[model samples]
Target: MQLAQLLIFLILFPLIAAFFLFLAKRDLDRAWIVKLSALTIGIVSVYLLISTYDKGGLMVSGIPAEPTGMIMFILEMLIALAILYLGIVHKKWLVVALIIIQSAVMLYFELVYAHAIHVQSNLFIDEFSNILALIIGIIGSLICVYSLGYMKFFHEHHPEMPDRRPWFFAVMFVFIAAMFGLVFSNNLLWVYFFWEVTTLCSFLLIGYTKTEEATNNAFLALWMNLLGGIAFAVAIVYLAMFGNGIMGLDELLASGKIIALIPAALIGFAGLTKAAQLPFSSWLVGAMVAPTPVSALLHSSTMVKAGVYIIVRLAPIFQSTFTGYLIAMVGALTFLIASGIAISQSNAKRVLAYSTIANLGLIVACAGIGTYEAIWAAILLIVFHAISKSLLFLSVGTVEHRIKSREIDDMNGLIVRMPKIAAMMVIGMAGMFLAPFGMLISKWAAIRAFMDAPYGFVFVIILVFGSAMTLFFWAKWMGKIIAVTSDGKNIEGEVDHSEWAALVSLAGLSLITTLVFPLLSTKLLEPFLMENYGHVAQLSQDNIIIMMMMLMLLVILPLSILIPTRKHRHVSPYMSGRTTTHDMRFSGSLGVQKKTVLSSYYLTEYFGEMKLKTAGIWLCSALIGIMFVATALQGVIL
Candidate 1:
C-alpha cells in the first residue's frame, strides 16, 4: 500500500496538476495551482526519500503489464504524430522523415518483435532512482514555482509577444511527470516512452515564443533528438533480437557479459545526443533563447540530465570495452573544449550552458570508466551539478531582469546593484569549481577514478586542463560580480518574492549539501555503491576536514557581505592629479573629462566560437564514427 501510494504520488500527481494548470486562466489561478502542486510534490518526494532511506531501497513488481504497455504504445504514437505535424508545419523534412522512420520502427518492434516478451518487473526502485526522483520532484517543482514569478517579468519585457504562460506552466509540470517516470521505470520500453515525452515537452517549451529563431532552434533540437530516438529505437530492436530475452534494465545489467556491442553503442550514441555532447551541444546552447526557467529546467534538472542518466545506467555494460574507451575519450575531449570555449563567451547564460556541457562531459567520462569510484563520482556530480547549476541559471535570469542584459560586463559591481542575488551567485559559482563544494569533490573523485583506469593518463591530462579552464572562466565571472566599483546601482526590491524564495532555497541547498557531503557520501552514495559493486569508495579524513574548512569560508564569505561592517575604510581610486570628478574620471590632454572603465579579458580572438566549435564538432564526430565502426567490427568478430 505504501509503495503504491508513493508511486502514484511521484508519477501521477504532477500529471494531474498539469491538466489543472493548463486550464488556469488568471494569474491568481496559476499561482495557487503552481504553489499547491509544488508543495505537494515536494512533500511527497521528501516522504519518499525518507521511506527509501529507512528501507535502504524498494522494488515493486507484478504491475498489470498489458494495459500499461498499451497505454505507453499509444502515447508514443501520439507524440510521434505531434512531432510529425510540427515538422510539416515548420517545413522541416528531416524532422518529419526521422519521426516517420522512428514511428514505423517502434511499431514493428512493439507489434511484432516484442509482442511476446514479458518483462517481469516493469518498475524498479532503488537509491539511484530515489535520488533522481528527489531531484526531479524537488528541484524541478521549484523551477516551476520560479517560473510563476519569472514568466510575469518575461511577458512584461516582451509585451509584443503573445502570452503563453498557461501552456508554459502546463508543459513544465508535464516535464516533471515525464522525468519522474523516466528515472523510476526498469523496463527499457517504458523508459523510452518517458524519454519521448521529455523530448516533446522540450520541443514545446523551447518553441513557446513561436518566433522564427525559436522555431528554427526548436526544430534543430527536435531533429537531433529524433536522430537519438531513432538510435534508441534501433538499440531496442537489437536488444530484443539478440538479448536472449533480456527485456529490462535489471536483466540487462545482470547479463552484461553476453550483451552485444551494437545495442550498447547505439544507446551510447543516443545518450550523446541527449546529453548535448559536442556535435549535438549546439541545441543546448541555443536553448538559452528560451525563458530562464526553461533553461534552468532543461539544462540543470531535466532534459540534458536524461542523457547522462541513460549513459550512467548502461555504464556497467560498457565498462572496459573499446567502445567504452572511445566514449570516455569523447567525454574528456568535450570537457576540455567546452571549458575552453566558455572562456570566450560573454553572455552569462551561454557561459553557464557551456559549463553545463563541460560538467556533463566529466560525468559521462566517469560513467564510461565504469568503476565503482567512477560511478560514485558520476552520481555525486549529477546531484551537485543539478543544485548548483539551477541556482546559477536562476541567478542569471534574475540578474538579466534587473540589468536588462545577460552579459558578464553588464554585471560589473553587481555586489552593489543586487547584493543579495550577487551573494547567491557567488555561492553558486564557488560551488561549481571551488573546494569544499560538491562539484569540486566529485571532480576530485573522478580524477582519482580515472587514475585507476587503463590508459587513464590521457583522461587525467584532459581533466587537469579542463579544471584549469573552468577556474579561469568561473573566477572571471565571480570577479565581475563581486568587484567593488564606484558606479553601482541599487535594484534590490525589483525582483519578486517568488524568485527570491526559489533562489534562497537552492542557495541553501548548495551550502547545506556541501556541509553534509560526508553524511551524504556515507548514507546515500556509499550504500548504493556497496550494494551494486560489493565495495564502497572512501574519502580521506584529512580531505574531509579540508572540505569542511573551505565550506566554512564559503558560509562566512557570503555572510560577511550580508552583515554590516564598519572596520573597513572606503577610498576613492587614485587618479592622477588631473582628476576631473569624484567618480573615476580624468582630465585628458585636450581638457575633456574621461570616465574610467574596466572590462573582463575574454580573448575572443583565440577562444572564439567560430575558432573552437567547428573543430570540436568534427573531432567529436570522428570519435563517434570510430565508436560505431569499432562496435560493428566487434560484432562481426563475435
Candidate 2:
C-alpha cells in the first residue's frame, strides 16, 4: 500500500475497531477483535517505518482539505460539548470554565487565523516520529491486549462494580489512534486536535468506574490537561498572528526562536502540565485509581510521552535561550524532587509513578539543553523507559490480582509465589536502575551532554544526586519482589494468557532493545540526528566498550544464579539470634519461638511524600512563574 494509504489506515482503522468493540458486548468476540486489530496495527506500523525510513522523510499531499477540516471541526465541537456536559453535570465549574476558554480560543483561531492560511502538509513522517509511532502502535496495542485479560479479572475481583470493558477497550483504541495522529501531524492545528482527543480519552478511561473518587480524579486530570490545551490554543493563535502566518512545524522551526520562542515557551508550558511535572503530578497519581492498563498506557506510551515529544520537537528553538534554561531548571528540580518522593512510596504503583515523573524530568531536561548529545540521550530515554516501565506496571498488575495488594510490603515473598511475574518485575527494575542496563546508558549520555552545557554544574549535580536516589527506591522494590519466604504458595499458573503474552513481549523487548543498542545508535539514531544538527553524537570507544562489558556482566550474573551448584549441608538463614532452618524462626528471650519479619526502610522523615511533594510544587511553581515573567519580557522587546 502507498504511504498515505497506510497513514490513513493506521489512523482510521483503530477508530473503526473501537466502534465495533464498543458495540460487541460478548466476551469471546471482544477478545478476537482486539487481538486482530492489535496484530494489524503493529505490523502496519513497522511497514510505515520502513517506507518513511527509505525516503528519509515524507509528507502526505493531496489530503482532502475542506471536507477533512470540516470533519475535524465538527469532532472538536463534539469533544468540547462532551467535556462541557461532564463538567456541568459533575458541578465542576473550574473544568467548565477551562473547556469554554479553550473551545472559544479554538473557534476564534479557526475562523480568524486558520482559514486564510493554507497548510500544504498536514501529515508528515520522519525517523523521529517513526520511533514514537512504533511505541504507540506496538507497545500501546500490547497494553490493550493485556487489558482484555486484566479487565476480566478485575470484574471478577470487584463483582460489586459493573463491567465497563466495552467502554474501556474502545477508549484505549481511540487513545492509540489519537497518539498516531499527534506524532505524525505536521500542521500545528492538526496536532492540537489530536492533543485534545487524547485528553478526552484519558478523562473517560480514568473515570471508567464512575465511582466518586474515580470521577473526581478524572475531572482533576481533565482540568489540568485542559489548562495545557488552552495554552496550546493560544500558542497556535500567537504563531498565526505574528509568526509570518506559519502553522506548519517545519515553517515554525525555520522562523527560528526570534519568532517562535514565545509560542514555544507557551507550548512548553503545556508540555510541563501533560508530562506531570511537580504540581501537575497529582493528576497522574490520582489516575492510579483507574485500571492498571490505563496507568501503563498513560505513564509509559501515550499522554505523558506526547508532552515530552512536543518539548523535544521544539528543542531547536529553545537551544541556548533563557527559555531552554528555564525548562532545564524545571526539569532538573523535578528530577531531584520526584526521585526523593519515590523513596517514600510503599505502594508499588506510586513508586513507579514517581519514577516515571523523575525520568520524564530527565528527558525534558535533555530536550531543554537541545544539544546534539542531549537530544540523542532524550530519545533513548523515551524508548527504553516506555518498554521497561510498561513491563513493570503490567507485572505489578498481575501480581496485584494474585496477591490482592499493590503494597510493596505485601509482596515480600513474590519470588516464591509467582516466579515468572516476579522475575519480569525484577528485570524491569534492574533495567531502569543504576547498572549496566537500558536506562543507564541513556543517562550516561545525558551526563556527557550536560557536562558541556552552560550552567552545566547545576544539571550535573541534580542528575547525579537524583539518579542515586532513583537507585535507592528501585533497589528496595526489587528486593521485595525477589525476597524469599516459607509461607507463600506458587500462583504463576493462574495468570491470564493475554496478560502473559504482553508481559513476555515487553520483557523480551526490554532485553532486545538493550542488546541492539549499538546498532540502534549507529543505524537509526545517528542518521536521524544528521538531518537536524549537521552531525551525530557519539560515545567514545572506551565508554562503548565499558557499556557492552557491563551488559555482558548483567547477563553472566543472572546465568550464574541459574547454574546448578554443588550440594552442601543445609544451614539456617540468619535472623538476629539463633535461627532454625524451618520457618525462619529465631530464639528470643527465654528461648520463646519467634518468627522474624523484615521491612523496607522508607526514611519517611527525610523523604516524606507529602513534605517533599509540597515543597516541589511550591518551588516548581516559583520557577514557572519566573520563566513566564522572563519570557514575557523577552517577547515585549520584539
Candidate 3:
C-alpha cells in the first residue's frame, strides 16, 4: 500500500503543485514552494524504491473494462484536437496537417474495423520500473535542487525579465511526474497518455525563456517530437484494433508476432528524435539557449533518458529483424557524426551538448546490438552519464557566471581564479572520458556486444573510431582550461554559495555512483535483464579487478604530476625559432609580434549548421517516409 500511495504521490503531487505555483506566481515569497514541492516528490520517490525491494511485482490499478480499441480511438481524437489547438496558437500549419492525417487514420481504425479485447495485466512494478523510478526520483530530485540555485542566478542575470519561475518549475516537476507514470505503467495506452503529457511539458519548458530564439527552437523541438508522437499514436491504435485490444505492454510483448517489429522500429525512430540522434540533433543543441539548469535537467538527466528508455524496453521484439540492422546503422551514424562535430566547437556548452548526443547514439546502438551484455551496457551508460553530464553542465554554468563567457579560450587558466570549481570540472570531465571509469566500462561492453553479432563488424569499426574522436574533443577542452602563462600564475574567478552547492553535490554524486556500481549491477540491473531476456551471464571477476587497479593507478599517478608542477620552475611553451613575449604572441622579424590565438577547428565546411541543415532535413524526411511505408507493409509481409 505504501508503494501504491508512493506512485500516486509521485504522479499527483507535481500536478497539484503546478496549479498552486501558477496561482502564487505574483509573489516572490512563494518561490520556496518550488523547492518544498520537489523535496516532497523526492522523498516519495525514495520511499517507493525502498518499498518495492522485498516486493516482486505489485499492480497499482486496474484498466477500464471498456474495449481498449474504442477507448484508444476516443483518446486519440482528443489528442488530435489538443494538437490542433497548439497549431492554431503557434501558427504552425505543418502540425495541423500532421494531426489531420493522424485523425483520419484513427477514424478508419475505429469505425471501419472491429477487434476483440483481451485483458492480461493492469499496472505493474518490476525491477526495470523500479530502477527507472529511482533514476527519476533521485537524479531528478538533484536536478530540482540544483535548479533552485541556477534559477536564482538566472533571474539576477536577467533582472528586467518577467518572472516565470512558477511556470518553469511547475513544468519541470510535472515532467518528472510524467516520466514516473511512463515507466511504471503496464497499460500501453496509459503509457501513451503519459508520453504525450511529457511532450507537452517539454514544449513548455524548452520555451521557458520566451525569447525569439527560444520560441523558434522550441517549435523545432515541438514539430520533431510531434512526428514521433504521431508514430506512437498510430502504433497504439493498430495494436488496439488487431492484436486483442488489450493495450497492456506485457500482453503485447507476449503476443509473438514479427509484425510487432513495425511498431518497434517506429518507436525507435521516436527515440531517435527525442534522443537527438544526428539529423534530429539540432533541437537539443538549440535547447542550450535556455537557462543552464534546464539544460542540465532535460538534456542530461531526464527528457533524453526517456527516449532511450523506451527503445531499450522494446529491444526484445526487434532484435532479430532487419529493423535491428537499420537501428544499429542510425545509431552508429549519429555517434560518428556528432563526435566529429564536437571536435570543431569552441563553445563549452556546445561541446557538452554534442557529446551528449554522441553518448546517447552509442546507447541506442547498444540497444540495437540487443545482447544481454549490450542491454547491460546501455543501462550502465544511462546512470553514469547522468551523473557526470549533469555535474559538468552545472559547473560550466557556474564558471560562465563568474567569467562572463562560455568560450573555452576565455576559460584558459581557470584553475588560478576558481580552483575548487575548476577541480570539480576536471573531475567531471575525466569521469566522462571513456577509459577506466563507468562510461568506459559501458563502451567496452558495447564493443563486445557488437563484435559478437553476426555481420556486425562495421558497427564495431564505427564505435572504435567514435571513441577516439570523443577522446580528442574532451582532452582538447580539458587542456585548454588549464593552459597557463609562462610565469605560472593561475587564472582567477569567484562564485556564490548556490553555485558552489550545485557543483559540489553533482561532483560528489558522480564519484559515489562509480564506487557503488557493482552493488547496482547485481541487485538492480541483473534481475531486470533475467526477467525479460533470460540467461544472465556473470561478468568476469578478473575484469572487475583490473578496472579497480587501473583507477587506483590514476589516483597515484595524478599526484606525481601535481607534485612536480608545484615545485618546478615554469617555462614558455615551444615556439619555432622566434623569441616570444606576451603569452601567445611571438616576435616576427623586424619587431612585429604575431598573436597566436587558440581556437578549435569548427569544420564549418562539413558539420556547420548552415552547411548540413538542408541535407539533414531531406534525409530525416526520407527516413521517416521509409518507416511509414515499412510499417504499413508489415500487414502484407507477415
What lDDT is reached at residue 84 by model 1?
88
The TM-scores, one per candidate, come to 0.98, 0.97, 0.89
Runs in model 3 deviating more than 4 A are: 24-31, 54-58, 61-83, 100-120, 486-494, 555-586, 593-596, 603-635
Please provide the root mean square deviation of candidate 1 (C-alpha atoms, Å): 1.4
Ranking by lDDT: 2, 1, 3
Which runs of model 2 end up more than 4 angstroms from their true locations?
557-571, 579-581, 590-592
Report model 2's TM-score to 2 decimal places: 0.97
lDDT digits (tens) for residues 1-638 of candidate 3: 66556676777787787777766755354456766776787677667777787455666665453564366457657867987897888788887887787667656655644344444555678777777777777677677766766677778888877778877777877788888878877776667667777777777787888888888887788787777777776786767656557466776667664546766676778788888876788889998988888888877657788898888888777675556666766777778778877877888999899889889988888887777878888898888888888888988887787788999888777765665666777778878884567898888878888888777799899899988889888887877766664343333333545456657777777666776677777877787778778846456889778767777765543344344456655565668777866566888779698886666555677666455445545655565566557655764687
| Clashes within 3 Å, all models in order | 0, 0, 5
Give, for candidate 1, the lowest lDDT window spanning 10 residues.
Answer: 567-576
What TM-score does structure 1 among the candidates reach? 0.98
Q: Which model is ahead, 2 or 3, in terms of lDDT?
A: 2
lDDT of 2 by residue, 115-229 (tens): 6777888888888889999999999999999999999999998999999888889999999999999998888888988999999999999998989999999999999999899
